[model samples]
Target chain A: MSTTSSVPDAHEGARNDQAPAPAPRGPVARPGSRLLHRWVWLRLSLLLSAPLAWMVLIYVVALAALLITSLWSVDSLSSEIDRTWTLDNFRTLIENEVYRNVTVRTVGVALAVTVIDVAIALPIAFYMAKVASPRARRMLVVAVLTPLWASYLVKVFSWRVVLSEGGLAEWSGLGSPGYGLTAVVITQAYIWLPYVILPIFAALERVPDSLLEAAGDLGAPTSMVVRSIVMPLLVPGIVAGAIFSFSLTLGDYITVNIVGGANQMLGNLVFVNAGAANNLPLAAAIAMIPIVVMLVLLTAIRRTGALENI
Target chain B: MTLSSTARRTLAVLTAAVLVLIYLPLLVVVLNSVNPNQSMTWPIEGVTFEWWRRAADSAGVREALATSLQVAAIATGIALVLGTLLALALQRYSFFGKHSVNLLVILPIALPGVVTGIALNNGFRGILGIDLSLWTIVIAHATFCIVTVFNNVQARLRRMGTSLEEASADLGAGVFTTFRLVTLPQLRSALLAGGMLAFALSFDEIIVTTFTAGGGANTLPIWILNNMFRPNQAPVVNVVAVVLILFSIVPVWLAQRLSSDVEAAR
Candidate 1:
């Protein structure tokens, strides 16, 4: 709802025309009118100011400060920030092979997780949306959403156990990939599946049954129908789902620390630099990677109308 | 579309299998919480309530739970107010820079948690010259948590036109009276869902909490992380996880039921 959606005062008065005549404006009505009616700006200001201050002063300013801090560096021995501005942190990030490798590895794993989630979410989401009875659909949604409320650490730790030596994988006669990038990707994909499922299910629900029937009546097979008609409509939702898994995976450090064995992502790099090394400047610089990547991705998806879906 | 029986059968099987796969690991966690072996090795360990008993007695766990509850409650409370107001402003008044405001609201969630963490960490320590504390965490959480409340309230307001509020206003009731009697009643379920979601989100958050929380404080997630590597505490950690996962259903179910009630009314 925005100002444009709000009915004008004149329109409201028009609706009230059918009602019995209002009592004459007494002195008590004058102050109220002066505040809420005579000055629309005051009403708007009262509603808008506090929240705008919070979003701008706290969130936006903090982000801007972080961007500036990335330009500075620290003195190694003293462990104090040098206020002198330089591109040295960015230069180091560029020249360092480990940072370069970690960046590439994180992006690849994020993409893998997104792909895995989409592949799994599609058929299940479609089933929930179209094939299931209404009660069954509601039950399915609750079943999927319950795990989301479960603690994130618990879920990741559960994966750590499953991939542990002599765990379920071994019990079932399948060798576990055992704590590494593979485990990280699997755990990330699993954690984000419900999230991706909901959006895709909503998108699929919007596809009218008549359109699908028309395609089927025209002799197109199920696969052909999904490929041609439903797929196009599903793209925005898919893009929206992909955003959740990819960005969530990219910035995740705790999951990697638990499941990634010796592997490190860009998150680990930043975590180490910030927490372990206490090199905030370097950490802030490293953070630019994911922020920039996400900004670019968000802008690209805005064109697809996936941003609104999100 | 009328699918062949074979195709429908295949899709159904795939969906069922995926659901099973999703729940399998979580089932393991619940079982592990009761396993007798401290090592928690594979192959059918005997079950016992030892971990549950120990977890109940732990002071650290108690303190962590208390901290987590307080943080979530305060954060959710702040988010509820701020998010509702923002949603009201955005939804009711056409204002300049509304698109920018929308982007601002979405960024905290869309950006990597690490980025949000460090940014707030830096701002709290460097720019603001404030100590990292529970207040900082609540603030950080409110920033991100606003989006859920905002989205819910915005959608609710969109679905509910301004007619009732206008009628109240046209009846000679002032703005505050109209909001109190008409608008708030309309917003009750939406607010309930949004507040529960914000609470859930804050309770589960770790990365940003990791950065914002002072050295003295440990929320439940942080507590779990620290205890996970402690050999004696691992099973108790499992028990804690089980409790939380079990408790998760309440709010989610309530929220779902509430929203469905609205739909059924319509």
Candidate 2:
């Protein structure tokens, strides 16, 4: 639409200039307008140059470098990158039961967190979007978002205090399950709840009330109305929220360290190998698992057109 | 649309319960900040402002806070420029690889922070031969921060059309003049909201900062992590956290105000 409209003006300006050219009585505007018309590509290039350079050079190139580095082997004792190209890291990852176990554990925790968030988010988001009055909706939005701004590590530590010995759990007479995989899942779910709530609530808000009315008018039960009508449409939003909950949990090692007791997630494994263990290549290879998982997840959901929803 | 009174009450009660659960930990932090006991076992033996007083006097706390502000500010500035430019170019022109550009912008945040952190760690030290510092942290942050500003600005630009710029050009204004006089006014609020969101994101970030800040820098999250384990300083962390949460309300409100309804929520 924009390109087609701009073309006529470019031509008209050129025509107006040509009609006045070769007279030389006044300064000719022909060259300038004609140059501008012919230089549309240059304008685009200029607009794109800085950002394209920034993204490509800094982000894309760095990601590519990491993938390449993963294929190379690192000397453990020497703490140096060995130039010899080898698939040893990949072979090691496949052969090692620990890596497989950690990957499964990380993916399980992520899925559990996503399911918990979605289940909790659904009702609350529906109530906020559909049941609350205008003023209450505004206040609820603020209430939901405020905690997200609170420092993350602080929140995790807050959880630590709450779950510690003689803390809230024990004080309330419920047995403290203590910090471990269960605590990690709970903490991650707490951390990511707002991210899930906002998106699902936004999608729910966009669901027209008239559609529900139509379903009711057709003599469908409320359960049927929701199950068949609302549920299908809400899947994309749920998936969008799931992506955040899943991927964020996949990459998190800090929460696991603070709250998780002696259990290693994939993030912990990669982190230890990368920095503390001083095996960059192995760390890079371990990192590749999450990268590939995310790529596949992103591609799978791309068809749902939920990327824009995020 | 069709629910009984019992169902409505159930939903409302559930929501209220969730809200309580959400604030429970934060309430603990706020209360623990004033608890006099340095050991910080939950019951609140007594109350005092000793932790706040200590936090005020601590030089290390001051330095870390300063570093966080500096890193967030610089990274936010860079994201604003690069993000707005990217949004404009993508929104205005029909170009090849446009979808690819969108994917590239989202990749840093969505792919997982650990991957991005180590990727940049290798890129900075091995590939680029630059030592890790606050600048490396800023660069890593700006890369992820770009997505927030880009999404905000892109949403605004899509809603805003090219007709106004065309009218300005028809009035004999050049490209820069039209952009300055016409395009920018519409984008002001978007830029403000995006910049604030970017600032908050970089300010709270930890994982990438861990990999990139290297041996010598101290951002607030890093500071909080270090102090959290120390028995005496743990109370000080609660004080800092309560203060940080209090400080955050203003920007969160302002960002919500600047963007339409729930657009920023997205």
Candidate 3:
């Protein structure tokens, strides 16, 4: 709607070519006009420079501040900030049993979630990409995307009801406490499944059906065709989806806090330290651990061209 | 040449099962919200509007809803304008450090939400000594939401090509006038789509909001989080949860429909 209206102005401008030519020539004969053009260009350049420079400056400052805070140690007695630059906070985090446990749990959950989500999403994505008719494909895509559109909090809250002791399971005659590691995994898997599915769908759509038909003509069995042709081609998409889901789940605070119950993921620990404990330095340090890991993983993915595939 | 009937049936069943799994929990919450009994028991003893009525009357719920709407609207607005400007600038001019600028713009959304949240939290509170507030949440959200807008606008700009703008300039319109008329119209659907997506992203965001919202700023998500563990308020929370879910889904559905319309038109 907006783009269509702008066309006429361009058309009108094209019709006005004769007016600027004579004015420019008259101005070109005067020294003042030459100076005016230079001045105008200079001002325009400066005007553009300010916003661009501001963006770069703010990014640098924010990142540097985070790095500095992540390095600082927290006072043992009052749990207040100790402004000295030291590796003590990192060392303490590495050695602390609770921190170690939470860190491992976070990674384990994230990996588990990524693997499960990819496993579930791949077949459906493949079906939509290869098997479904155009109308059916569109319907399937919309179905997959619908959950992503729903509120994150509402999704988590719904999981609480579904997984609670007396909620969906008990009502449906599948009795269980409903809140534990299983519940947490299910919630995270449900929330992030679309993230994995969308990229894989995009990648699978790029593969021509003719190649698959050729494989089938060569007397390859279904399983053999999948293993030899489809899986190999979809590796990059799988990796991209895995990275997205893994990193997102690793840093998530809500899923673990809501569904994990007694289980403390690293994100939950960071949230608590920052919110309840008011231990900003410790929280900052905890936050840095996941950031560093994500950067390394993403860099590896990009170098492998997996991200570009998505 | 086609799949066997049994195989087709199996695949259809599997797809149906997965869809059921995807939607069951959400359906359960909506059903349980109106249950007369407070407990989320099976067979749904009786349907009632008690929880919905309570949720509507709750001051905290209303306040949180207003806060979330206000913050998301402001954040999305800022993101759309700034992001559109950034996209135009990058599209028009070739300059030094362009790669770095592109990286900076993409970094926030590319990085984990926790990292961006922590970075903003640390920068604002520890380094700048500013208290966390609604403004902080808006700023944090805008940082990432801008990327969505930028991606949308830039993609459309690339598709439209430079000829249209150049033709406008050739006809004697000033750059600003050209932008207002020729360029802006072409970018409308992209902007609208981007703005809606950004608003939805900001509305349901919890991680960044947690870091940037101090003691006082209670967004709807945060309010729900606080009440999640309270036994008496669980059903009421369910009502709010349903509302929030509807809020996000509606905009996303509209955006999807808009994009499909654009595609069909083309």
Candidate 4:
């Protein structure tokens, strides 16, 4: 946009008598001019240094503190800070039965939610992108996206009322299995559904209509057309959505607290440690586990070019 | 080759069923809010707006709402400035470690809220010896909120390209002036969209707030969580939830509109 506007100014500069004409040069410059160019380069680099260094410093320091704290120990009763480094915190997490159960449950719940969300979202996204009328499509997209704006706490809290005995589930003849792994899964799936849906819809929108039509014209079955064309095109989006759901559910503690009853996910454990136990080191240590997992997954996605697609 | 009438009808029924399933819980909340009875019965006997009025009158709920708004606003502002700056720097420059910087920016958002909460709590309280308060909540929120703003601005920056800024530089405008007059105007939509989305995210955040908020520092969501089980407060909780849902809907709707405009313009 600015390029077109600058042409007149460039021409004006060219026509001005005060401005020197451009001098064509080979690889060499006058000594004085070279010195001036070097000075300018030095000044520009100096000007850029502070902000760049500040950003790097902040990132490093924050991460370093977190890492170092994770290695430290905690006094059990008083919850006082102990400077001595030990592997006990990490070992406790690994060896503790409750922590192990929570870790498995957290991963299990996230996976189940991601799978169910993807299964439900894909067909609707496909329909909205390709089959629905423009108005209906718009409405459907809006409907899916609207729930995301609702307060996260309120949404989870609402699920408490909804999944409890004589709540929505009971009203609908589905028995309320109050505050269990099942409720956690249902609520997480509901919350994360839009996250999965929006990206998949965006991805499906990229698939050319002509390709689908051509497939249909070639006597391809609906299933075959979906398999051959749509599915291949949507892999990146689906992966992106799954990553979002998985990571979100993995990190989430609120839903598990409100719905999972006695089930302690990593998030719940972190909260418990931080708030009740004041086991900052152990909490920090547990926190690193999710970050490591996320980084590994993100790196794999980037290598596959799916990160860019997202 | 076409789907028969019966098949299409069945599909339509299935779609409607799923929609109903998705919406039922929300519908129930809305219904129960107005129910005059003590128990939240299915039929929801004799609707009244008393709960809504009660929610408006409740001092604790009002205070929480105000606190939530203030924290969210501050967090959103911080995110908007930092995120836009980072986005511009990453987009305009070809520097070493740019990829790592980008990853770092995205890391907070991708990591679970609990992890972020715990990390920030540890850093602030453990390392810095600072008490958790509204500022702590804002900082924690801004950390994640940065990703939203960065994503929006980066996407806009990619679409816009660097020609404008380069042209401004060529015209002898100072870098700051060029950014203000040229780049800022181009980024207006993204800034607004990002700001609104960030505000929504921060306003609704619970996990981070749960960790960062100290004694006597309760946001609306935290307040709701605490009062959700109380019978007197249950109706108020519903009212607050409805209000919050409405508050978020406006920004999200605006974001959707802005995005659609950008899409169409592209």
The model with the greatest DockQ is 1
Better of 1 and 3 by TM-score: 1
Which residue ranges in model 2 land beyond 4 Å of their true spot? A1-38, A302-310, B259-266
lDDT per model, in order?
A: 0.86, 0.84, 0.79, 0.78
Number of residue pairs clashing in candidate 3, backbone atoms closer than 3 angstroms, sequence gap of 3 or more or interchain: 7
Chain A accuracy of model 3 expressed as TM-score: 0.81
- Model 3 docking grade: acceptable
DockQ of 3: 0.49
For B1-266, candidate 3 gives per-residue lDDT tens digits of 13457766767777778889999988998899888877676568878998989998999998998999999899899888878877876766566767787788888777777777777887888788899898888888888888889889989998999887666554545555556778998999999988988988888899878888877889988998899889889989999878866766787678678978988988
Quote the positional error of residue A178 for candidate 3 in Å: 2.5
Q: For candidate 4, what TM-score does chain B get against the true chain B? A: 0.92
Error of 2 at B29 (Å): 0.5
Instruction: List model 2 lDDT by residue over B1-266, tens digit each.
Output: 48778888999999999899899998888898888777667688878998999999999899999999999999999999999989988888788999999889988998888999888988887678798998999999999999999998999899888777666555444466557768998898888889988999999998888888967799999999888878778889889988987887888777666555546546
Candidate 4 per-residue C-alpha lDDT over A1-310 given as tens digits, one digit per residue, 9 for 90 to 100: 3333332333212111334423432222333433333353343444345434534444445567888998998887677989898888889888988777777788899899999999988877867787678888888877777787877777787788787766777877867888989999999998898899888999999999888888888899878887889888999889989999999999998888788888778887788887787788898888887887777877887888876766
Complex DockQ per candidate:
0.55, 0.49, 0.49, 0.42
Models sorted by lDDT, best on top: 1, 2, 3, 4
For every model shown, the clashing-pair count is 9, 0, 7, 0
Identify the superior model by DockQ, candidate 1 or candidate 4.
Answer: 1
Inter-residue clash pairs, candidate 3: A2-B185, A3-B185, A3-B186, A6-B181, A6-B182, A13-B171, A14-B171
Which lDDT tens digits does candidate 1 get at residues B1-266?
78877777887898889889989998998898888878676765677999999999999999999999999999999999999999998998887898899889988988999999999998898778899888999999999999999999999999999988776665555567567778998999889889999999999999989889998889999999999878898889989989988998798778777877978998
Order of quality (DockQ)? 1, 2, 3, 4
Error of 2 at A86 (Å): 0.5
